[model samples]
Target chain A: MGRAILTLLWKDLRVELRTKEILTTMMVLALLILVILNVAMGQNVVTVKLAASGVLWVVFTFAATLGLSRVFLVEKERGQLSGILLAPMDRSAIFLGKMIGSTILVLLVEAVALPVFVVLFNFPLGGRVGPLLLPLFLGTVGFIAVETLFSAISAQTRLREILLPLLAFPVAMPALVGAVGATAKVLDGLPLQSAAPELQLLVAFDILFVAIGLVVFEYVVEEE
Target chain B: MVQEDRRAVEARGVKKAFGRTWALRGVDLEVRPGEYLALLGPNGSGKTTLLRILATLIRPTEGNIRIFGRDPRREGEECRRLLGFVGHDSFLYGSLSVSENLHFYARLFGLPDIPARTRQVLEALGLERRAHDLVRTLSRGLQQRVAIARALLHDPILLLLDEPFTGLDAQASRSLGELLASLRQEGRAIIMATHNLNEGLEACDRAVILLDGRVARVMEGPEIRGERLREAFLATLES
Candidate 1:
């Protein structure tokens, strides 16, 4: 099992690195959203840019959905699900590898985007930023798990690329709400204890979404 | 009917329906160890449906299936470990090179000496030269060969092949024929669902004809030859 997960993870990570499809597109999209934010917030003076941090995180979360769907699009287009299913490993391992791969891709974009946002918006990203990282990571985990499973399920259906976000974002609203709420506190200099419930909610979202995905994976893999 | 005979795999009065469309209307058949059985039928005749039931991919609406005396419905995970399937499309991840695909599955099957086993399977399938090639870059025949290798990696005792010969050329089909024969020699029971009647009979010890989701007839040995098997397939289709 360990070997299977590692190999699967290695395969996804390696291909993603070579093609640079997921990271490049997502990073560019994140940057573009920041550009739009600068223009829109330029007209306002109510600390809209500061509030835009939460807005920007939401934007990244939603935009990352596109990258997630595209990641699996190659596999589905090439009929590679059958290949993964036949790999003689626990099907859950594939789900985990995909989740990890997308999570890393999202984080890569996040790393660069944060510094750029801090520099451009000038909101002092270090105001208890150490604590804020927790929500970002939790939200990313939940977001990726939901997206990975939906990608697998939607891969078979028609309009797969469109269907992924439709299924993912609606089912993921709870995590989204929790991350936004918890992050607002982290950026405002609250202690870790103040952010605990929302953090816990994100964790619950991760665990529950993963469990649901694992249960339905066999059905999605079965040839209809 | 649960025949008291020594059966390697058996399905009794199995029925499955998807929505209002009934795919199988009580499919009952049995094969003992080492038997090569071909399931012949036209599309919508329920060949794949019955195979999936035996594979425990879905439950039969009404009926039971046992493989080696174990109820597949109740013991799907165990049944899965003992069974291998190769279908029309090989489900090899195109991004992963051949060796990585083999190694990944080896780990999934929890095999010790994964490198050795993967190497052996690749060599046996004559894929050693292309083991580093991405599956997307391989020819259809080569990809199907890799699909067969994926199935054989676990050394399953029972094999279910759905249209396994679809994209293969003569040589690839012959190699596959040889592989199944070798498995039969080692006491494995095989079930291949195919539309190609001629090749189906040539590869199997018995050919069972299914008509609109039921077993219509069974032919064995010398009766399964040349155009004769195709005629049987047509008869099943007509019925």
Candidate 2:
């Protein structure tokens, strides 16, 4: 099972590396959002500080959805999902593999966007970079966990392009709120403990979705 | 040795319905070890549905199916371990190179010495030269060969092929027929669904015609001659 999951992750990463489809689209969109935020907010330190967390998450959420939707769309379009299903491994392993791939891609996009965001808005990072990493990882994992499963479900639908965000946004609201709160707290130079509640919420969200994704994934992949 | 006597595939009263439409109303089939059975049917005759059910890609709306004495629904992982399936869709990732695609499936099946296994399958399928080419860049015939290689990677006992020759030219089709013949001689059971009556009858040990979700006719040995098989297929469809 571990080998199967790793192979799946490796396959997805290799495809993305060659095509750069997911990363290119995501990075461009993130940069565009940052540019829009810069134009709308106009380098006002006080306002930028207050809106930075919210804008960053809002952009990440939408861009992540765009990337997540493609996670399974490529498989569905080429009918490769059937091949994966035919493998003699537990279906949850496929979910884990996709979730890991998506999380990595989303993080890469975030990593690129963060520096540009900081420089664009002239926002202060102070010395809180170490404390920020945990929330970023947890939040991204929680977001991708839910999005990956929902993307699979939506990919099977005729209106998948529109259906993915519709199905994912409401379910992903809690995680998004927690991420924004944690980012805001950290950016404000608050003590690590100050964002502990949001971090806990993000962790719980990740666990709940990852558990549900494992159990429900088989049914989702089944042909109607 | 005793396991060889076990039916490679067995289906009784298997029915599959999509929404209110019944693709397979009631079907019964049985294939012995080392037998190659060809499934012939017109469009919408439920041939693909039956193959999908046997592959465990979809569940039956009613009745039962057993692959090597194990129920697909109850023992899907085990059934999959014993079965290999190739359908109209190549099931290969277009963006991945041929070798990469096979390697991925080899790893998924947890086959040891992945590099060696991948090389062996590629060589068997005559895809060694094209192994590094992305699947999307290959011709349809070559892509189909890669699909067959991926399915054969795990060395399944029973192989299910749906319209395997749909897009192949005469040369590629003949090569594929030779490969299936070799596999059959090696004692692997195979069920192939196709529309080409002559090829189907030539390659298979028995031929079954499906019409309106039921087995309309079954022919074996001398009864599976090309002209007779086509006549039976036409007669069944007309009726």
TM-score of each: 0.87, 0.97
Deviation from native of the Cα of residue A78 in model 2, angstroms: 0.5
Q: Cα miss at A2, model 2 (Å)?
A: 1.1
> Model 1 over residues A9-125: C-alpha lDDT tens digits?
887887776677788888888888887787767635357534854765766786698798887678767656555654445667777778887888888888888887766776665
Tell me candidate 2's interface RMSD: 0.8
**Cα TM-score of candidate 2:** 0.97
| Interface RMSD, per-candidate values to 1 decimal | 3.5, 0.8
Q: Highest DockQ, which number?
A: 2
Q: Give the poorly placed runs of model 2, Cα more than 4 Å off.
A: B1-3
- Put down candidate 1 lDDT per residue, B101-205, tens digits, no spaces: 777667777778888899899998999999999887999989888888888888888888888888789888888788778777777789999877645456578
Candidate 1, pairs of clashing residues: A82-B91, A83-B91, A83-B92, A87-B105, A89-B108
